[model samples]
Target: MITVSAPPPPPPPQPQPPAGHAAAPEPARGRRWPTVVTSLVLLALLMFAQSFRFPNDSAVTEPMVASGDASAAVDAGSFTVKVDEVRFAKAIGDGAEDSGLSDFAPETEYIEANGVWVVVFMEVTATEKQLTTFESRLDSGDENVYASTSWLYNTFGSVDDGFPPGIPIKGAAAFEVPEKALKDPVVQMTISSGPGQRLAGEAHVKLGLSGDELKKAIDGAEETLDVPAPEMQKV
Candidate 1:
């Protein structure tokens, strides 16, 4: 009586889950499909991006071929230029037309050529009002390069000087190259940003001439050409 004996005769044992029926599995760990797919996609994109490479500037070849007499203009960033005419001669006289050898006495009056002389007439309009320099060369089909001789004598003043914006200056460039190299030629002009500066860009004017044209130039090589004066015009 004092111990209340037997208490409640040990409360009945708690019921256990039925065999083969497990307690609800912890909410199946969240499926990682979304995160896994996102990682795979990012990896694929990265691999694809690394497969391509940009071309090097040095590897770039010359631009499209342009005709010397083409109405289209050649743009060289700092200046826009056009080739007006192309002529050839055996010798170049002292800029003056009627001047005799005596007029240039003491100094050589004409520039004699070992082969033939190539003269290119060009018009250049400066995009910027600044001092700059231009270089020209004649490229032969045979891979020969003939530099312009316009600066050697007083023939045509150089386009490489101070230029006024929106004004075009017309001048001639001369080169002496072997006769065999004259078959098919191309004139190229390189522009410099300023004196002693590196070359900015180049403009190529192709001399698309037939065999007859080349023959005509060669036939007239004996005559002397008077260097024409440069004229200015509106850009």
Candidate 2:
């Protein structure tokens, strides 16, 4: 027998994976820390860079304020106002005596003050168009923000007093506050053309009636001060 059977052809070489296809060794648990640390450093750097910049202007939500003394004319964009006098009164009116109101009313109208009445006489003028509404607020270095009292509706000053363009409406805005509220009293007048008045122009009239001057006003308060009736004529 020619037992010369050709040596079985060497088994086909076992299929070999390409060099790039070799299974990658599992990464050491500690090896991931460098990548995590690098990511953290980048995030911290981003936050640090932001700290050097000033605050965004849009975040300033305070209204634009125009400040002046009692006699000075303060321009509040839509309207200009000039405060003439500030009076402290024990009572506003009595049906027998003058009510400080122009119109006469029956049934014995007497707007007596619980604390004291601070009347601010002012002339308001519209800059662009006729404005029918305005507002006043009192800041007396206290917790309470006193608004105009409704008790003096018939008095010269109305929250919605009409102001024509270029013309002035002379009236008085009244606030009833305690005698102690005289110190550092500031009255703010607000006018707006639209519905919302946020960031709008405001007039901060500094009545030189604080400190020693404040005491004088309290001492010289009228028994019954008369608030001139609101009229179109500028006084």
Q: Pick the TM-score winner.
A: 2
TM-score of 1: 0.63
Best by lDDT: 2
lDDT of 1 by residue, 82-112 (tens): 8877788888864643446647555436777
Give the TM-score comparing model 2 with the true structure, all chains together.
0.65
Superposed by TM-score, candidate 2 places the C-alpha of residue 197 at a distance from the truth, in angstroms, of 1.8
Determine the backbone clash count of candidate 1. Answer: 0
Candidate 2 residue spans exceeding 4 A from truth: 1-63, 94-108, 142-144, 155-159
RMSD of each: 9.2, 10.1
Per-residue lDDT, model 2, residue 82, is 89
lDDT of 1: 0.68
Tens digit per residue, CA lDDT, model 2, 68-93: 87768989787888888888888885
What local distance difference test score does each model get?
Answer: 0.68, 0.74
